[model samples]
Target: MRKPLPFGISVFVALMLLASQAFAAPKSDLWPMWNQSNEANAASFDHQKWQQILDKYVVVKGQHNLFNYSAVTPSDKALLDQYIVDLTSLDPRNYSKDEQFAYWVNLYNALTVQLILDEYPVKSITKLGGFLSFGPWDDDVTRIAGKKLTLNDIEHRILRPIWNDERIHYAVNCASLGCPNLAQTAFTGENTEELLNEAAKQFTNSDKGAKIDGNTLTLSSIYEWYGVDFGNNEQAVLKAIDVFRDGQKLEGWSGKIKYDYDWDLNQP
Candidate 1:
């Protein structure tokens, strides 16, 4: 038979046991209430307003899609504000999976543009403020279906986890040159897949996306940061890239990869 331990020893052991139990428990899914099975309601979420705004402000300069931030007219700003209001008024759960995906992606991109406009003349999006002044990603920028959400919440909690599609990285733009080009038009449920494919193909072919210099295969840091999403390894990332490249092979590929990123605002 074992004797009872001292009070301090007993307390320490109990704390350790509790800690282990806590660590073993699975984390709860954040968007557990999001209705994934709902079929798309025919009630279209109008993106015409967003399309107008994009057409008026975004321009294709050389290879980059640059927004004329300084040229945004008062009317365009009003249109953007109204678009956000219209978006937040909808109940996303009523929409289909594809619709919801488009909704979130559009909302993220629009809000990002808004952030830049709100603080125009800034060199980079990373300079915006949020919790602890780290960035604007954590700021509670909007509400959908009565739940307030930050940009990070929309991206990580909802979009990334729900869709589980690597191509999503292309769909949602970061308003930076290093990030995938912001689509010139608004994303609608009808065009989400096509738009995603186009964005991926365009980016993969761009010098900013991938470049071969001698023996080195340089890629966007996006692949370095989210390689798991592309495929969990370097070779897997190359495979995904090749898919968009239409089976084009990189000869003399030394199996070496380098990552680069440009934080300059995609501006004109």
Candidate 2:
């Protein structure tokens, strides 16, 4: 026979569930990028607050979005425009090594976000191009840490070698609504590990990379797009994802994955 539960135990169980519902702070919500979410929209990041923060921190530049964690709503094209202006005005050359790294990562992500915002509400990023293109990833006008660089530069030159982390490809979203939700915060030097891991987990756990359906696994194009980085082929990519995923095994996954893309603005 089972013993009866104590009165205090019963109350404690109820409290535990209620406490969980109250929502604990997410270890990973501090973004090194931007996203348009209802929660982010509610914030009113004041310009004054940012100026003050810059005065105190090692921020490489004084461009917009550097201190604009206000959680504004919708995250329209106008915000991206202002941020680009601010980003270009910043001078990473004046900063220290670590400070410059942080600045470039942010600069790459910020300009990309604005590109999407400029073509808001579109279905496919390709539509914005003149003839045949996947969008602005090929464009040269994108800025990074106050310098004019292409999306390719930010990815291949800065993020790849210095960081040696392909996971960043997933972090610096292109802002197509179909892209992973724009991160709600900026990536700061202080919380680099926390934010990067969070992004990897979110992208892998979601349909973007790995999905569960009893025994079968459905994957995202990211695996294929960067397969060379993962390994010579698909198996290597699955292995990388497996390292981050818990419980869920790669049992039968061989990188023979499905592909899906959303041309949306990733907007709310």
Q: Highest lDDT: give the candidate number.
A: 1
In model 2, the number of clashes is: 12
The estimated TM-scores of all candidates read 0.85, 0.63
For the record, the alpha-carbon RMSD of candidate 2 to the native fold, in angstroms, is 19.2
What residue runs in model 2 are displaced by over 4 Å at the alpha carbon?
1-79, 142-147, 251-256
Error of 1 at 73 (Å): 0.9
When summed lDDT is taken over every stretch of 10 residues in candidate 1, the lowest stretch is 20-29
User: On residues 1-268, what C-alpha lDDT tens digit does candidate 1 reach at each position?
Assistant: 9999999999889867754442121111357666463683666678888899888888998779998889998789888989999999988888888788888888898999899889988998867875224357778999877788988788878887788888888888878898899998788889988999999998888878888777778899888777778876677888888788743454335677798878789998
Error at 198, model 2, angstroms: 0.7
Cα lDDT, model 2, residue 164: 61
Off by over 4 Å in 1: 1-30, 35-37, 246-252
- Pick out the ten consecutive residues of candidate 2 with the lowest summed lDDT: 58-67
